[model samples]
Target chain A: MLPVFDVVLAAAILVSAALALWVRDRIAAVSGFLVTGLLVSLSWLRLGAPDVALAEAAIGAGLTGALLLRSAHRIPCAPSKALPPSLWCAAGALAIAISGAIVWTVTSFGAAPVYPSLVADNLPESGAQNPVTAVLLNFRAWDTLLEIAVLFVALTVVIMVAPARPRTAPLGPLVQPFARVLLPLTVLIGGHLLWQGGHAPGGAFQAGAVLAGGAIALGLSGVIGSKLTRQNGLALLAIAGLAIFALAALAAEVLTGALLGYPAGEAKTWIIAIESALTLSIAATLFLLFFGPAERH
Target chain B: MSELSLLVLLPFLAATLTVAVPGRAASLGLVATAANALLVVSLCREIIARGAVEQVIGGWAAPLGITFVGDGLAAVMLAMTAIVSLAITAQAMSTPGRAGFWPLWMATLGALNGLFLSGDLFNLYVAFEILGLAAVGLTALAGTPMALRAAFDYLTAGLAGSLLILLGIALSYSVTGRVDLETVVVLTESSNGRIALALIAAGLAVKAALFPLHFWMPAAHSSAVPVASALLSALVVKGALYLALRLSIEGGAGAEFLRSALAVLGTGGMLWGAWNALRAERLKLLVAHSTVAQIGLIALAIGVAGDPLQNGLWTAAALLMLSHALAKAAMFLAVGRIAEALGHDRISGLNREELRPGAAEFAFAIAAISLVGLPPTAGFIGKWILIEGLVDEGAVHWIALLLLGTALSAAYLSRVVSRCLRGGPHVSATAQRLPWRSGDVAALGLATGALLLGLAAALPLTLLEVPFA
Candidate 1:
């Protein structure tokens, strides 16, 4: 019964992915993409990777879908031109070939499955009970450090481009009450996720996405985006995560002789400190990216 | 503090500070570049003294944790990056660019350091992500419709290349249950491993702008500000080429198929880029195309150098990269100065009777000489090593290809050098000397460095002897 449900879900994913490519309307294509992300996250859950699933749903689907929806509104709502039949055929062929190659390769992999057992054995000293958290915050903190830099670079690029101020309409009367509820709910969820990261499937990214969703909604409602321009402290908040993370990593090395090496019993403290800063930074960055950095001065 | 980690992370911290305090950006950028140069020099010394230095991040052992390795190749690249970055920073200081340039440049520097030092494939991918985005921002800093279009195309191409790299890493991880560079040998044991490498090579080829996939590079390079162009053409693309080199060295005999294919593509890019460069109307465009050809030459060297562990001939590729970065950066900076003085960049407009060729033009000629493999320049020495190696291996056809590439380079570069040499008939009696600027000094210094590196080639050669950690 579960296998049948998985197959159906996979088929649904393929259908929605194809729809995203073929849809004529910008909103429709984005909606299709969002559906695909959602279904893929569900597949991850079935595979027992709730951490990946949470990230895929929140950041990959939720935040990205919001960003795309904003872009769709700004862009002219026109039907996309159809590609030539030959071009379509060529694309289909290439896609099929790539999928076939991936399938063939995955089936033949003689994977030694090294990391899971290794993470398990070392989880005690890592200061995080969750193996995923242990790996992300302690075992391989360097990659996470670089990953934050990647996010920061993306934010920098978006700020560098200095997009034209987005024109937003006034919100309806119902939005105030809606936002009042959403604002608190988002804060609650974000705090819960940040606190739960060390022991559960929630983390900085998912929490940030939830917070950004609220921020973006507020932005679209003409409530506060105007005041939070690039000149505001939002930029400082955005830089805080990377700045703190890099300093901590360097300080760890100075204190312990190993890059990103935490204190013997204080790894959880370090990880939580980093993630709390990251949650705020990521939220500010995503909010800034979705809304314009400046809104007509 | 470990210099290797500092070299990568300090730039990032500086970039953040620059963003936070925009008024102090220039000071922050200068300090960061100085610190970066010092770290690179110190790291090179450490690598020489210790035979290679490795730092285990988070104190987690390999196959679980990432490591930063300062090997012979990494040390030289870092040194080369330091040299170019300092010069570019000098130019940037002299010419105040858009508000965003400093932060973007600092981020790019950090990304390049991370790239060269990273030993984990996944970690390398993350570095590429930052590098690619920062470079795209640098390109878009020109704030023109053309620059924006070029930046978008560059971003698309970079993302496509990155996708291929990530896919290859994923497959390799599945094959070996590890993402460390050493697991490459295990991945190559099966057809799946070979395919993964092929995918990675293909992706890196795009990033390196290796032939057939190099279409997005020239426009992107030519459309940016001068320092940005120099950064993109001379340094940014080298990240991909560096990874390709690492893979070839690690893969060894197993990478033969990919190497041969790279050689064939490099041969094509050699002719193709030269052909396009000869017909280029603008000076910057010509230099950009020449980069494509020069990358082909370096790729050819990597292709022909069979086992670096045995023969160490791949050092020729490193030398070529070193020379090209210096020569190409010098050419771009010099072109920027010439364009500034003349008010235009058209090759036909180079012989302005009112203003005789000055330091900038002279710098361009010397850079072209190095690029054309003339004696007493690093380019010539690099080619000499590559040619002598081929001869030792009895690979005469490879020798023929190098000579052909050499002649083509001289032909296209002479198009500008000959124009710059116009003096007796073309110059007016009242021709004025160009005013001194920091750009001229930077260009001349880098050009002279390329020229003298021929005599000093042994310095880098000695550095390149340090083994991988």
Candidate 2:
């Protein structure tokens, strides 16, 4: 039987998704997207995947929403361009129909999963108590490594094409003091999350995201200033995760004769070391992505 | 690291270094390109000696981890990428442009290498993202409004395509319980699997810029700077088509429908692209349109080839891709020099009587000959093999279409070829000065390679014989 809360959350998610897609005002659309992301996080929680739920709330809802809102504010809000209403309605109908078909297909075709048993079997050797963390950092480290490469590529592309960020005006006195108090606490929590990731639900990605949020908050309020955020040190930090990860892979291969093969009996040490570096890099990359390339000034 | 991993990692490492260090990008990129070419040779040699090499990343086997496969087909594609990239790198170094080109170019190379070698569906999608974003960055490097606009459109198309591909992978995983190529045969047994395969094929078609879906291609291809245009036309689009070929190989019986549809669309693209090329006002626009037609021909070959069991047909397709890459890169580089000399790229203005066509124009003519499948060129050998294979299959109508397409290519290319050879009334009696640059040398060398490949047809064909099955 379907749970009542699940049904309500799903419906709310759908409504917010529709609002995000159809709203004429850019700001309203962005808000809708944020709401949808938050609702999706709730759904993830209901599905009993707290790790995914936290990630959804932080990265998907928090970071993405902030990015969208900032961009929307930067671009002048013109009246939404209109297509023929009939055409719009047809597209809308088609989208709805396709989505309905997809949901129906998924619900109707339930199959047994193979990963759980395999993961359970390999859990002890994976160096992390949490299956998700183990899978992310040990069993499938190559994916994690390449995923960082994807982020690096994004940063490279943005650096090549994106215009310089417009000069930000100072926010009110409240924002500065709020950021000062919030910043240290955010860092502390982020570090805790990073530490907890080995045997629990929190990891580098979530921790980095939270840390990045704090950094962005400080930057946004003009308390830290763009110059500090955009320094050469920051640039190096932005790429540190990818570089370190790649080097570690090569180092592992050199020592073990297999690509990304961690040395025997030292998995936990290596995983932790890699995660620490990744945490820094991911935070820097996320911050850079939000703020654009570092300026010399 | 094994040579297989190095083939991808070296370029990635180069990309990082090239981006991290400024003003040194040119030399670093060149060294990387040269190193990469050597790596490809070693890889090809290894493949030739051994049947195929496969590696599981992080010491983890498939169904749970990614794999890299270096088969004959992949090696051939990698070789082509390396060659074209080498020429582009040489051209980029000699020509003055934005500092952003080297890192992006290297990243694209890394992505292309990854795409070719990746043995799983999900990894290929990641490679596609890198390729797509890097290509878009290259497009916008022109820094012109039109270029930026075209990049925007290309981005939209690419993202839509990526989403479709991701959805297809998800659906296929749901149906077949796995995401690797071996599971694709299993996917053919069910309706859901077929739909998933279809979605993947459709997405790849968009990226490959196949007909009807190719609306954004010409503008994006033409508006980029010369090296960017060459890479986009010669390598980026081919990456998508390569994945499609891989799909067809794995799809087994289910791919039959997709192949037939491809053939039909390919024929349409050939005729339509030719018509547009004939009418195109600018030289670069004509070249871009010709890419559309050439791609169509290659797609048609793949479609007609049908099953992977027919090695000859697939080889023909691969050869055509190789020949086209060489000829097209040469043509674009030559066009860059020609446009620079002529002060414009308008086809109508190409017959400047005040000036004699320079070595670049001569390079264009040679490249054009290859494009038209004239004698003593790689294009001719590729086409000859394709025609022979088609004839063996007793597909007469396809033969007629192929011949007609050939004639159409010749006719359109003659527009530039004739203009370059004969000076009109406006030709100045005083000899025009056209100093030879390294860029021209690189273009001519590539054109020469296209011509030489005809004489050395055994090389790539032998390399391509790594046994697909």
TM-score of 2: 0.96
- Whole-model alpha-carbon lDDT for candidate 2: 0.84
**Interface RMSD, per-candidate values to 1 decimal:** 1.0, 1.8
After superposition, which runs of candidate 2 have C-alpha atoms over 4 Å from their true positions?
Answer: A76-82, A85-97, A104-111, A294-297, B425-434
Q: Best candidate, lDDT-wise? A: 1
Expressed as tens digits, the lDDT of each residue in B83-159 for candidate 2 is 98889988998888585788789889988998999888888888898899889989988988999999999999998
Task: List the lowest-lDDT window of 10 residues for candidate 2 chain A.
Answer: A104-113
Q: For candidate 1, lDDT tens digit of each residue in A75-177?
A: 7755558899999999999989988988888788468878989998999899888888888888988888888888888887887676776567769888877
Give each model's whole-structure lDDT.
0.88, 0.84
Clashes found in each candidate (C-alpha, N, C closer than 3 A): 0, 5
Q: Write the per-residue lDDT of candidate 1 for residues B1-469, one digit (tens) a residue.
A: 8898889999999999998888889889999999999998888887777788888888887889988888899999999999999899988988976778888999999999999999999999989989999999999988889999899999999999999999999888777788999988777678988878888889999999999999999999999999999999999999999998999888877778777878888898998999999999998999999999999988998888886667878898998899999988999999988887766788876775546678888888888888888999878888898889889889999999999999999999988888876643432343346678787899999999999999999889988887766
